[model samples]
Structure formats: structure tokens, C-alpha cells
Target: MTLDLSALPPRRGRLAARPPAVPPGPPGAPGLRRLGLDPERDGLVLLPDGPGPFPLVVMLHGAGGVADGAVRLIAAAAERHGAAILAPESRDPRSWDLVRGGRCGPDVAFLDRALAATFAWLPVRAERIALAGFSDGGSYALSLGLANGDLFAAVLAFSPGFVAPPDYVGSPLVVVTHGSEDAVLPVTSCGRRVAASLDHAGYRLAYHEFAGGHVVPPDLADAALAAFLAD
Candidate 1:
């Protein structure tokens, strides 16, 4: 089914003047799975013990990434910043639309639903919302976040490979982190290339290179979360 990704919650900034989202193909068409994700039920939504209106970080997992471990890894940092975590499972259990980009697919539709559900029932500060992810998810975050800049004021990409945005939208601030010793998606190629491109495009970007591999340290996650939740 084609989901209405329009009607995003209102925010305080002027959105970019971009056309509406068009399905590059059938909205829910399935493709071959390459990386495979662990079984995820709906999206794992984690909120602090109590809250009125909290910042929200829409987190995406790596390729075939574990849901429990992924959320547990970042939940503490997000909570420390009084932010809610909306961890949506890609419709595909293997990977995200990062392979192609957010043109049209079931994963994008699922994201539309996830955002709608979050805003409908959760206490989210629409203006403070962000799109973040790790590995493949991180790459996808860069693509989708830039495409929906008005909706997501900030974007946090951790150890990303590349970005594929079919079109561009409003300009949003971005925070990118990569492991200098990353073997899967090496920092020299993946992270550096993406960061350079985003910088060239004139988007407000913060790029960080750590001395590790394809992993998100708590400190890195905390830093990204803090920046995502900041004003």
C-alpha cells in the first residue's frame, strides 16, 4: 500500500520548496534480500520513565542488525537527553532502502506509518525530531534526512557507507561519525566520501572519525544523541 508520507507534524522552521514524494515504483514491492535483518515486531519504541514532550530520535539499525542490542546500545544516551527512541524495523528483515535510496518501497511506507504513529500517540517535540541510524541504516538516514530536512531538523549518521537521495529538500544540520579503522565500510571511502559530498553541498555538517572499526561506541552514540537533541 502507498502510505501518505505527507502531513508530517508541524515544526518551527520554513520547509524547503520541494515537490511531494513520488513512488519510483510500486510502493510495497519486495526486492531480493542481501543482508537480512533479525525479526523485528513493529518498531521498538522506548521512552523515558516519565515525560510530557520529549525530543525524538528515529533510529535505524544496521544490516541484519539485532533490534534488542541496537536499541539497548543507544537508549541510555537518548534517555539521558530526555529523548524518546523510535526504532522502526525495516519492512524487510535484511536491510534498508539504502541500497537504492528513498525513492519508493515498503520500508519507506513503513517509516511513514512509524512517524504517524509516533506523533499520534507519543509526546514528541516535532521541531526537535531527528533521523539517525548505524551502518546501512546510517547511510539511509543521510539520504532520507536530507530529503526531509523540514521534517527532521537534525540527522545523525554513524559509520555510514554512502547516501542516495533521489532528490534534495530543505537543508538540515547533520552529524556524521565513522571509525578510522572501519573495515566493512572503510572511513577513507565511505564516511569520508559522504562527509565531503555533504560538505560540498553546503549543508551544516559535523564529521567525526574515531579510532575503531564498524561499531558505535557509547560515547559516540551519546555525542550523536546529544547533538540530535540539542536546540
Candidate 2:
């Protein structure tokens, strides 16, 4: 069944203009088993954890390109939330095709494959699945979430860099969190501007700017994420 975005809880900032979620095809449907893309070659799996039959989150790395630090953090977060996690390695250092000016190549096609592969490989619920990233990864999440609206439940970007606005979907849930004093990918350059653009675009967004800089504060991340993900 198509989901009613209005049924979801209210978030901070403007209401999201989300496209209706595309319902799952069918049990063991061929469409469900294949997105017919590839990620194993260019994408890397970090740490995997969480309970069975839960929502899956595909974590893309920042400019650092799948650093061990990010892998550990995302693994821990997935374990804590009981959500399955998949972290794909960037082809280049701290890059996700946004900087290199390559379209329909590895970076763009990577997500398409990763989503299909994860959906087929994991035993999680599709409706609850999400895409999340930090920095460049955050930008990718926004891109993928908007482009593949029917595939993701939510899009979370932490200190994201430049992002191209997506055509308005119905009540899309967008979460942008950034520290007020970030030197790397400054809040002003990343989160704030994106939030404003999303606001203007009519997306349901939760824009959070904490006092700190560039890092996801544990307390704030937990609280805000909880509220953001709550049904």
C-alpha cells in the first residue's frame, strides 16, 4: 500500500514535499531481488550488525572515503538501534562523485546497485529502510533519497556538502544536523543552506544546529534521530 506521509509524526522546519512511496512488489518477486547494479567492485562493506528483519540503513562515507572511524561509528549506531547497516567504500578519497563531475558512472550507479543489492541480500523490511551519510555521504543521501523516492523511508545528512535539490515528492522526511562551528564543511556552507533550500522546496525537514562544530554530538544525535525516526 502507498504510505500516507501525513500519518508520520511532525518534524521541525517546513513540511516535506515527498513523492508517494512505491510499494514493495511482491513476495520473492524478481523485481525485489534485483536492481541489476553493482557495488561490490567499487563499494565496500564496513561493519554489519543489528537484529533480524529490521530496517536497513546504507551509510556512505564522507571525503575520507570509508574511514575506519566512520565504519565503527555507523556499526555501533546500527547495533544500538537494531537497524541493519551497510557502509559502502568510496572509489576515491573522501569522494562521492559530487566533486569529480562524473555522472552515470560509479558514484551514481553505485547507489542504485547498493540499494538493490542490500534489499536482496538482507532480510529486512523494505518500507522501513533508509539512506544516511555524513558530509559527502550526506549529500549522496539527499540525492539518492530524492531520486529514488520510492525506495527510502527517510534521508539523513550530517554536515553535508553541496546538494542538488530534488523535485518535490509528497512529505519527504529530511534530517539535516550540523554543528554551528564546523571548519570542515562549515554548517553555513552545508547544513544551513541545504535546510533553507529544502524549506523552500516544501519538504518536511528537521534542521538542527548545535553549539559545537563538525561532529555529531552523541546526545543530540540520539535524541534528534529518535524523534526524527519515530512513527
Model 1's lDDT to the true fold?
Answer: 0.72
Relative to the unseen true structure, what is the C-alpha lDDT of residue 133 in candidate 1, on a scale of 0 to 100? 89
Model 2 Cα lDDT, one tens digit per residue, 1-231? 733433444221112332124433322311112222334334434323433455666667777665344455455555566665666665566477554563324454445445445544456665666677887778877866666555567787878886663343445578888888899888876788999988887877888898987776666545534644574
The C-alpha stretches of model 1 lying farther than 4 A from their native spots are 1-41, 100-103
Clashes of 2: 15
Off by over 4 Å in 2: 1-51, 102-104, 165-170
lDDT of 1 by residue, 1-231 (tens): 744554443232123222123312211212111122224446666766553466778888888874555577688788678777778776666788545443446666567766665565566666788889899889878887887887888999999999877557788889999999999999989999999999999988889899999999899889887776664
Q: Scored by Cα lDDT, where does model 2 land?
A: 0.60
| Candidate number with greatest TM-score | 1
In angstroms, give how far residue 114 of model 2 lies from its true place: 2.6
Looking at model 2, which ten-residue stretch has the lowest summed lDDT? 26-35
- The local lDDT score (0 to 100) that residue 116 gets in candidate 2 is 48
